[model samples]
Target: MDGQRDEGYVVVVNSEEQYSVWPQGRELPAGWRETGERGSRESCLAHIDEVWTDMRPLTLRREMADGTGR
Candidate 1:
């Protein structure tokens, strides 16, 4: 399958803001919600790369923000 013209994918995010590509028109797993961006898998992954700059999970980020993660 061509990356540019595949079955299509949707960008989904969890509470941690971690992103992943899910099959378009399929039910997302629990705790994951669509970021409203849908396109080729490559595009979805690119979107994840751009938006998920901080690789830390939400809880860890909060802890770091509170100066406790260290």
Candidate 2:
């Protein structure tokens, strides 16, 4: 493994809604949920780019909605 690329990947999301790519067969760390998108690393990264437009934390988003996150 050169670490430059991976053949199998899965898109994962955490409780905070952040996105990341994980190796396909590895166990996801706590707080992350697999989003059901599985493919190559590039595709998984592309999926994250497509969906994760807002980089704010989930707590921040909730607070902003309630007008308190300043």
Candidate 3:
């Protein structure tokens, strides 16, 4: 089988005072989606901050078994 994996980090800066790092295309934990859409940008940023904090660290990597790293 041939397949390709894309990996990267997402830095969400909803506002100046708050931000979050979403690794490997992973969505923020449950409830965060709702939080990001509600109220002010600051509030959304704060929600991201709270969700990402203390979560396990992540390392993104993509290697193709077929040797094409596509």
lDDT of 2 by residue, 6-66 (tens): 6688999999999999988788899999999988889899989999999998999999999
Task: Write the residue-wise lDDT of candidate 1 on 1-70 in tens digits.
Answer: 6343464789999998888988887788999999999888888888889999999899999999999987
Model 2 reaches what TM-score against the true structure? 0.88
The residue pairs that clash in candidate 3, if any, are none
Off by over 4 Å in 2: 1-5
Report the lDDT tens digits of candidate 3 across residue range 1-70: 1231322334454322234544434567643322233433345455667666533322112234345454
> What's each prediction's TM-score?
0.87, 0.88, 0.27
The total of clashing pairs for model 2 equals: 0
Q: TM-score of the candidate numbered 1?
A: 0.87
Ranking of all candidate structures by their TM-score, best first: 2, 1, 3
Overall lDDT per candidate, in order of appearance: 0.87, 0.90, 0.41
- How many residue pairs clash per model? 0, 0, 0
**Model 2 pairs whose backbones collide:** none
